[model samples]
Target: MDWPAVAAAAAAGLAPTTPIAVTLANRVIACSAAARAAGVRRGLRRREAQARCPEVHVVTADPARDARHFETVIAAVDALIPRAEVLRPGLLVLAVRGAARYFGSEQAAAERLVDAVAAAGAECQVGIADQLPTAVFAARAGRIVEPGADALFLSNLSIRQLSTEPSLAPPSRENLADLLWRMGIRKIGQFAELPRSDVASRFGADGVAAHRFACGEPGRGPSGRDPDGELDAVMNCDPPIDRVDAAAFAGRSLASTLHRSLEAAGVGCTRLAIHAITANGQELERVWRCAEPLTEDATADRVRWQLDGWLNRRNAQDRPDGPITVLRLRPVEVVSAEALQLPLWGGIGEEDRLRARRALVRVQGLLGPDAVRVPVLSGGRGPAERITFAALGDELVPQANPDQPWPGRLPEPSPTVLLDDPVELFDADGNPVRVTTRGLFSTDPFRLDAPGRSGRLSWWAGPWPVDERWWDPALKSGRTARVQVLLGPDPAQALLLCYRQRRWYLEGAYE
Candidate 1:
């Protein structure tokens, strides 16, 4: 479900038929189906979307509002399955076996849940499958997959759908989908044919994870064996926490303590149960199931989301009469972290790597999905173009085939940083340095200058001609030449400089 668009329309008091776009950072993140018909799409800038469809209603993305409104729907689903695990604010999954047994058929259970959601004032469809990801795809098509036929069910799906549905593939992996298509793996089954180990080596850890999803394997491979002792974190509110801010503060504290405990046990939580007691003695609980192990910040997010849902639910019968007085987090399922397969090659050991990942995830949660990124090797003529930065947790798919010959790639020991704002080089007479048509410097460069960096050149190398993508006129970069320059006494103080269109610019710096 595109919850953002639905929540935005409802909050703005717009009818469901009205085209809506939920924007964040001045770009459309989600849009109503009607908006799609009108040519508005996600990732389009606000002005472009408006130009595409002038009647499209634009609204800001509000996660809290989305959670609040979705609470009623969650409650309705809970009525059918008390232990149903919430995957996100608008999505949930229940083991169909018990429900099917109770309702006498899987179809009946699906219809029952659909009607329940309808009564809650939201439309929903149910899909049953052996694996969650397959079920997500099935739900989208409103079809029930046959028993143990998840692979068959997923075989024909376009790789396009996996990235579009956040629950199936994450960290917004539209790039992964495109990479697969470019590699001639247009369908889920085609990609699934690759061996798991080979996929890991070629596309990295996240790719293997996606393979499992495509193959209809479990969400993650970590086995959730029982741990030695109780792993629970609790916090009691002195004055009932009535505000979302207060709940968030409490959640962070609890999450931090819980994370330390999990690390000590050398395990991670795949399933978490959030328990709360209201001032009126009403007990509320919800369980969250994650595709991968939960980080501290992710746990806190679940806590905050659950509390917000409870506090803001509009149902008169189900709403908490009094504020929440107690909150407890319990690990419903724990997996041995030592069994957790992290990236095969990294600088740090397993423990340090895990800690680093947690910190990055926490920062991303605090900031946004783009707050942190990791490099994925890509084919290019320059050091900066050799790799692309993908957000952490996403598949490390290359931008282009690295195996293909890159005739003019920079020599070994590439620069550590690529300057977005290139530095300029000036001649002894203060004229901008340039490489002549004869493939020689127009004038001897004297100084290199940038915002915080300034130096007189000590020594310099030849301006090697760079001609890239010459075969594709649309993709071709105009004539440029690179030079290596050292400043002052240290070999460590080296810069990668480029001359283009009669102007000198700094491309990178050697560490």
Candidate 2:
């Protein structure tokens, strides 16, 4: 492939003069003669490129966009060779048997595929062999071996190409080549000739694999179907979109792509990763994991939530230098889509809970994140004891056991309403009475008033006093006697009042 040329063109920000390709890492996946002649070399960083060749410009790597572009190139190649698998961002592997028959020869088919990709906006080098890995190696090395020449073709190349892992050799590829040269085994043929037992004992499995590759021994076949298959989509803009609306639009496109991919796989995802590339080449990545596996609409909602969360975090710190230009959405975990069974009477409670959760999320998004809360009961014995508003997501560790009974505590199905602060009142006889904040009566007497009656206290209900938590000062002051008032026209309209710290007040209504 014209990897060197492509690297040069990409680094220099120039149109390709000839067929060349580059990998995602910006390495020379292929290059043209003109680019190589311009002193452009493979594996040079974009910044290092300027020192080597002043006129060369650099383009940041855009894997998703590049993959999309490569799809067009692959379509063109498919016209010439029906069965082609895209092996990497810039590499292809094809079953050449059919193509060779259609084109009268394997070389002809290879040439046609190369030309087709080049015409489709890529500079490509093509290689055909009995195996995919070997073909990839030959293509990277800019060689197109004749059929049955696989052994001869690989026998002269360096062994570094045999393995995909970069750290197989401690000494590096160049050092390994140097070591082989010193051993008088400069070519793959000589390396392969080294006794297999000796190679295995000396360099371990990697060396054995390399030697086998040089000997043209086919390696293991393709892996079985990917469990977490590739499912991602991206949106690219000509001028690099920075507007929130533009990014949101791109998000919608990506969501649609994810939906299609998941539908094709017959699965749904619970987690997703979002990536945003700014115009200045900075990348922002965020992950969203849902409490429940998400529906399609919920997935989009999460995308928006994630975007807003990231933006707020970034803004709170400091705005980035540039506007984000590209947006990518990728689902990380997938499970088989199962039919959701509904109860015959319908899950109205669950539906209501979901609506409430959505409302809470919106409120939290608008206000600070801690603004929304759910009520939780505490161990103390006052209005605060009965309930506390805790921030959402906080642990709801029950302070008291549901099964074990507290001797003096109110029974299950506690009062629905609790007044934060109690109100004070005087009896019609003008006698001072005492009540605990829990509405229990103290030693001081409290007279109850009839319902709908303005002034007179009719009768008192409780001297059912409670002296609790005397050991703790905070609790001692809070826990006091409370009395139930049969106020107004009916005892059924009785109000629960409390006397605390030597004062009487209405604490709660007994509905």
Report every candidate's CA lDDT.
0.79, 0.56
lDDT for predicted candidate 1 compared with the true structure: 0.79
Candidate 1 lDDT over residue span 1-511, tens digit each: 6788887777777888999998765678889999999998888878799999999988877666787788888888888766677777677777777788999999999999999999988888788888777887788889999988999888898977668766445563677788888988889998889999888988886787788888888663212333233888888988888887667667767887899898889999888888888898988888787766888768877787778888877766677878889988888888898756556675358568667767776786577657788998877888877887876543455565566677877788888888755678889999887777777888888888877668788989878887655576675346778999998874348888877656667788777
CA shift of 393, model 1, Å? 19
Per-residue lDDT tens digits for candidate 2, residues 329-360, read 77765556663223677645865865676666
- After TM-score superposition, the amount by which residue 293's alpha carbon in candidate 1 deviates from its true location, in angstroms, is 1.9
TM-score of each: 0.65, 0.40
In candidate 1, stretches whose alpha carbon ends up further than 4 angstroms from where it belongs are: 170-176, 195-201, 218-229, 339-511
The TM-score obtained by model 1 is 0.65
